[model samples]
Target: MSETDTLRDNRDRGGPAQPLVLAQNLTKHFPIRSGLLNRQTATVHAVDGVSFAVHKGETLGIVGESGCGKSTTARLLIGLIELDDGTIVFDGDALGSAISLRDMRKSVQMVFQDSYASLNPRLTIEETIAFGPKVQGLADPLGRARDLLGKVGLDPNRFAHRYPHELSGGQRQRVNIARALAMSPRLVILDEAVSALDKSVEAQVLNLLCDLKDEFGLTYVFISHDLNVVRFISDRVLVMYLGEVVEVGPVEAIYGKQAHPYTASLFSAMPSMDPDNRTMEPPLSGDPPNPVNPPSGCRFHTRCRFAEDVCSGAKPALATFGNHPDHLAACHMHDPASGHSLAGAEASA
Candidate 1:
C-alpha cells in the first residue's frame, strides 16, 4: 500500500497497525533541594504518568499552558532527559533495552523554540545543518546540508555561508529545521518551534512544516500554546494540564466537541473575530496551581468552573466518552457506559 493510504487506514483504526513511537505511563519528577546541606525537600511533578502514541506519518499536536509538561514530554521522547518511570517503544524496539540511545537519536530529532539560541553563532548555516550528519559519519555532509536548505525553501547558494546572526528570525528557524532534518529522522519533536515568529512568518513556517512532513514521510509531535496553529497542523490533538493528559482525540473531536472542562476553558479563552459573539464562559480564573503540590484528584479542578465535589475527591481515568471510543477524556462527568451529560454543569456558575 502507498504510505498515504497506510496512514489513512491507521487513522481510521484509531492508530497505526503498529505505532512508530509509544510511551506508556511516562513520569518525570525533579527534586527540589533546600538548606545549606541541600536536602531534597520537595519534588516537581513535571510529567505525571503521561501516555500516548505517535503513529507513522501523523502529526500529534500537544497544547497546554506553560509548565504543563509539553516541552518536558518532548525532551523525554528524544532521550534528552531520563524518565523516572515509563517505557518508550520506538518502531517495535523498547528504548534503553533493544535500542541504544545513539540509535534512537538518529531516528528521532527535535527542533526547539528559540532558533537563534539553538544554532551556534559561530557556525555558518551550512555548517550548522551539516553538524549532525558529520557526527554520525554520513557521507557528503555538506552536500546533504545544501540539499536540505533548498528543500526547506532557503536558497543554498545565497544563505549557506551566512551565520545565524545574519538571518531574520524566520530564516534562522528554517535553518533550524534543516539541522533537524539532517539526520533524516522518522519522528520530529517540535517544541513551540514557531511561537516566536510574527503572524505572517508563523504561517510560512507552518506551511513549510506541512510540506516537509509529506516530503519526508515524517511523523511529528508538535507542542504549542497556540490553539489555532495546533488546529491547523495537527491530525490528532492531546490536551495536557499540569503534567497530565486531560483529553486526547482527533483534531475534529477536540475542536468540534471537547470533553474535559480544562480543554473547554482553553477554547473559551480564544478571542472571537465577531464582536457580537463573545464567549459566555469566564476565562481561566487563576494560574495553574503549583506543580510541586498539585491538587489531589483533578489537577485542573481548582480553575475549572464546572468542578464539583466529586472532582476534588477522586481521580478520573482517561477513558472513552459516549460512543466515541477514539475520543478520550479524564473527567468525572463522563461515564463510558451510560455517557452521562455534564453540559449543563459547564453552563452553570
Candidate 2:
C-alpha cells in the first residue's frame, strides 16, 4: 500500500484528527535481586508516574542528564518494553491493546543514537531501508526505499549496495533515517539521533531533519542529553530527573524564564554563545541519586540548590505559569492553585 492509503485507512478507522501521543502516569520498575534464588530485593523506579503528550506535527524534546529515564520513557511510549503502571495512549488507543503494535509500527518509527550499531552488519543499505516497507507490504518497496535514500541526500545507485561498515558515520546515520522514513511514519522518536556525530556533521544532520520534518509533515519526540540541540529543534521541552518531569514549557520559556531550579541549572550549565555577558552558572555537582531508592518528595532535591524542607516532604504537581496555559511545570516554585510565585525558593541547594 502507499503511504496515503495507509494513513487514510487509519483515519477512516475512527482515529482522532489531531492525534495525541501521551503517557498517562506511566511507570517502570526493574527488580534487583540479591541471591541465586533471584528473589526481588529492590526495585529501581526508572520512570515514576511520568506524564506528557506529543501533539501532531510538533516536536517535543525530552532532555536530561544520563540515567534520568529519558530513554526509558521513550522505550515505554513505543512499547519496546512493558510498563509496570499507567498507559501510553497513542491516537486514543492504549499501547499493547488488541490492535497489535505491529499495525502501529508503520506509523511510529525510531532513529537510534549509534547508526553503526543500529543497522545490521550483514544487510546492505538497500536491504536495510527496504525491510520496513516490505514488512508493511508497501507496493514498489525498493523504489520507495530509493526515493527515501534520495531524500536523505544519498545517491541510491552509488550507495544502496554498500554495507553499513562501508559508509561514513554521517552517511550511515542518513541511511538509518531513510530506513525509518521508508514507511512514512507520522511520529519519529529520535533517541539521541545526532549525539554520536562530529560537530560539523551534526549540524548537517540536524538541518536535514528539519527539512524532512517540513517535507513529510512529521511529528518528533527528540530525546537528547545535549541541551543546545534540544533547544534548537524543540517546540516544547520537558526536563526530567530521576524518572519524573521536573518542568515542561515552550523552548523559549525554558531557556529564558526557567521556573524549576533543575531546569534553570540545566540552562545555566550550557556554555554561553557570548562570553562577555556570561551569567551561566557552574556545572551541577554530585551524582543523581539512585533510582532504586530515589529521594523522598522531589527527586531533584538531592542536587537542587533551591531544595528546602518542603521539597523533601511535599511532591509538587504540574502547575501553569503566568497567563500561559501551554506552560506547565512540576515544581514548588509555582503554586498551581493560585499561580503565584514562591519567594526565595530558587536559591535553597
Candidate 3:
C-alpha cells in the first residue's frame, strides 16, 4: 500500500493502526562554554526525561511556563533540534537515531508562532502553501494548495493571491496552519499556534483546527502557555515544570481535579468566569531556577508549599492516585507513606 493509505489505515485504527508518535526519555542539553579553548561548561537541561505518545487524531496539549521546556520538547519531537538523549519514534520508525530528519519533514510539519515572520513576505499565499508540495515533488501541487486554502477558511481566488502583509493576524495564522497541512503530514506540531491571536480569533482558529482534525485525521502536539486553550483543544494534557513532566492525563482530570500541586497552581491561574471562584490564590512566586542548575529531587520542592526534607533530598516518581487511573503525577504530596496529605493539611489551614 502507498504511504498515505497506510497512514489513513493507522488513523482509522486509532494509531499507526499502531503508535504513530512515541517519545521515550527525550532530552536536550545545550553546553555552556568559557574561555578561548571553549571547554565544556554547564549544560542547560531544556528537555529532560520527558516521555509521551500521541495517537493519530488526538491533540496532546503540552502546557508550561515560558522557560519550562515545552517549545524545546516540540522541536525535539519533530527533529528540528538535536536531542542529547532519547528516542523519537514516528510511525514505528526511530527518528532520533536516523541519519537525517529531512526525510521525515513531510510526514511531520510544524506551525510556528509569529505568523508574520513564519511566512515569507516576498512569497504570495499560494506560493507559500505550495512550497512544501513542490519540495516533496507531489503531483498537482497547485491543486493541493488551493484545496488546503479553502480548508483553512481562506478563499483561493481571493486571499491566496495576496501577500502576508495584506492579511489580518488571524488570516496569517490560517495560512500558517494551511502550510502545515499542505504537506499532508500525519503529525502536526503547533508551537503556540494561536497564542499571538486575539481571544475571539483564537477561538475561531481553534475551532478551525478541530474541524481540520476530523476532516484530515490529524494528530497534533499542541504547545502553549495558555492553559485554557490547552484544556479546550486537547484530549490529554501534559504538564511540565523545570524540564520534566509533572503530570499528565485526560484534560478533565488535570483541569478539574488537579492532583499535583504544580498542576493545581496552573489551573488556579486560569481566568475563570465565576466571580466566586476568582478568590483563588495568587500565582506561585519566585522564578523557575536556571535550567543549568535546576533544583534537585522534585525540582518543584523549592516552591512547593508541601515540600519537606524528603522532597529536597529524594525525587518522587510519577504515580497514579485517587480515582483517576489515567491521571499521573510526580510529587511527594501524593505519596501515601510520606505522611504528607493535602486533604489533612488543607483542613488544618
Top lDDT model: 1
**Could you give candidate 1's per-residue lDDT for residues 80-131 as a string of tens digits?**
9999999999878889997898888988899999988999999999999999
TM-score for candidate 1, residues paired by index: 0.92
Comparing 1 with 2 on lDDT, the higher-scoring candidate is 1
**Residue 116 error for model 3, in Å?**
1.0
Ten-residue region with minimum lDDT total, candidate 3: 340-349
Better of 1 and 3 by TM-score: 1
lDDT string, candidate 3, 1-349, tens digits: 1455666665343334567788899989888999899998788889889998887678999998888999999988877788898888776777745524886776788999899999999999999999989988988788888888998999999987899999999999999999998887878999999999999999999999999888777889999998878978999999999899999999988877887888888877777889876855676887778889889988988888778887888788888855788788887777766555453343233
For lDDT, candidate 1 versus 3, the one ahead is: 1
lDDT of 3: 0.84
Which parts of model 3 are misplaced by more than 4 Å? 1-7, 10-17, 96-100, 275-277, 337-349
Report model 3's TM-score to 2 decimal places. Answer: 0.91
- Model 1 residue 1 distance off true place after TM-score fit, in angstroms: 19
> Candidate 2 residues 67-102, lDDT tens each?
889999988877798889997767776667835687
Computed on alpha carbons, the lDDT of every model, listed in order, comes to 0.88, 0.84, 0.84
